[model samples]
Target: MKLTLTIWRQKGPDSKGKFVSYPMDNVNPEMSMLECLDVLNESLAERGEEPVAFEHDCREGICGSCGFMISGVAHGPQPATTVCQLTMRHFKDGEELVLEPWRSRAFPFVKDLVVDRRAFDRIIESGGYISVSTGNAPDGNAIPVGKEESDRAMDAAACIGCGACVAACPNGSAALFTGAKIAHLGILPQGQPERDRRAVRMVAQMHEEGFGSCTNIGECTGVCPKEIPLEVIARMNRDYLGGAWRERKNVVTTIAPVSDWDFAKK
Candidate 1:
């Protein structure tokens, strides 16, 4: 199969980007998208031309390192599939695929099909883990978590932080990603001690990172490679509200004093 790839190209974060098209004459239907790119890169190297830049590691789709808009769809048109796992057979001969990087303020452009996702790392650092240290690894049956709770936690834990949720959202919201991180830990018994504080801090950090608010449009989950559920966002909101209310007194004390109290009498 033959295909044309119109890819976004930029030398650096501040450089001007443009679409550059490359026609492939020998595309194998069995080849994954990344593998096809590798073939293209080999050809480009042979001709002494610069190859297209994209992220990929462990092309099996577990790394979350490979992603970009393919023909305007995050991770191509396949549902719950990453770009590296998308086979060329999905497209027809003479088809043109347009590729672009994630376009969110929180995810600054790095180069062609690459963006800095460190903002996600910052949100995780805020309170995504249990700081308490257990002396040794416990037995599997020690915690005795309910089957339902464990299932939901595992569902939320599948989020790979690939930034596809933000890319697909019109509002550029990171709610889905943040919610998944919060829910996975919040549902677990090990996370019980810092549950309230974790929600408050992670949500606060998300806002500070310049991500948009969740309007419940549901775009985030629709394009998620892992199909992370929309309920995670609701869970995040519930926890944040509960935590904020509990921390209200401490929150108020941190605010600066009001100097014009007498004006109310007028």
Candidate 2:
């Protein structure tokens, strides 16, 4: 098989980047996407040219590190599959594939297919945690949790913090990501203590990081590798609203400007 790849190439964060084309032959359909790149890099090395830069780990799709825009989709044509799991057979014998990094103000390009996702870390640091002390492990059945509640919490917890949700959105929204984070903890009794403050701080950090607001277009859920449902966004909104009502007397601490507007319009 033969194919042409048009991939973005950037030397550094401040460098100007452009798409560079490469044509190759003898591609095997059974190879994973990263393996296909391995072949391409070997070819480039033979010609004394620099190879394309991309991110990957485990190559088994668990790390959520092998992320880049394939053709025009978040992780190629597959639904709920990461790029590392994407195989070459998805394409025809002779085809053209375009590759680029995740695009968002919060995720600046570091190189060809690598971007700075530290904004996500900052958002998590802001409030994506429970206040439980680090002590001895508790018994498994010490706290009673219904199956339905535990399942929902796990669904939200499935988010791998991949930026596909943001890349797929027309507004580059991080609501799905942020919402998943909030819903995971908000649904669990262990997270009750910081629930209100978590919503306020995390939402504020999300906006400050320059991620756009959700338009409810459903693109986030569509491309989510974890298949985290869009309903998580609704749950996030509900928790935020409930938190605000509980703290209505002390408006300054519980309400975030972005979330306040969203709640007011509702």
Candidate 3:
């Protein structure tokens, strides 16, 4: 199918950006979105034109590297499908698709369709791991973990850190991402030692990264390619509250909520 792609192009972080349109003919309906991009790049290269820069790794959607705004929606219109897994068949012939980078203060644009997601790594570094004796991998059934708890942990652990949560959120909040990381470890026995501390440290680092607070708009979960539930944010808030209650002296908390029509609402 033939399609028109309007892609955002920027030279560097400080450079200005604009949408450049290209008529994409000869696109196979079976080709994944990233594959379509590859075709475009090949055409550009043949013509000695600078190709668009986008992120992709393990194009199977396992890696969260491939993500950007597609037609004003994260990962396109499909639910729980990353851009790499999206196929050209989802679009109709002559359709115009707009692609842009994930917009957030924490995710500054590096180039065309690429944004620096290092802030997520910093949050994980703050406290997304557990302390354990270093050695060979332990047996799976060594610890008697309940099936329910394991399921919850697995659910939270599915987060790919794609930053779609931040991009979809009207407030540009990273609460969903941070919450997923916290819940992934907090629900497990091995993560007990740093459970409360993990919540505190990670939340602190998230704030430091300049990400906005969660407004409970639910847009984060709406765009999450992993389909991470909104309950993860609630879980994170609960953990943060518990941590603050326990370490009242150290948990410097300041919460200022935003409402679109609070003061003027009838």
**Model 2: per-residue lDDT, tens digit, 1-266?**
89888999988766679999888788898888888899999989999988888888888877778888889999888898898898889899889999989998778667789877777877888889998667999889988988999999999998888789998899998999899999999998898888987887787788778889888989888888899998989887887777766754543322222321122224
Q: Is candidate 2 or candidate 3 better by TM-score?
A: 3
What CA RMSD would candidate 2 show? 6.1
161-216: candidate 1 lDDT, tens digit per residue? 99999999988899999999999999989888888888888888888778898999
Between 1 and 2, whose lDDT is larger?
1
| Consecutive 10-residue window with the lowest summed lDDT within model 1 | 252-261
> Model 3: which ten-residue window has the lowest total lDDT?
257-266
RMSD of 3: 6.8
lDDT of 1 at 99: 88
Q: How close is every model to the real structure, measured as TM-score?
A: 0.92, 0.91, 0.92
Q: Candidate 3 residues 52-167, lDDT tens each? A: 99999999988899999999999999899999999989899999999999998777668899888888988898889999898999997888889999999999999999999999
lDDT of 3 at 146: 95
Q: What is each predicted model's overall lDDT from 0 to 1?
A: 0.87, 0.84, 0.89
Candidate 1 clashing pairs?
none
Model 3 spans with C-alpha error above 4 angstroms:
136-139, 248-266
lDDT of 2 at 4: 89
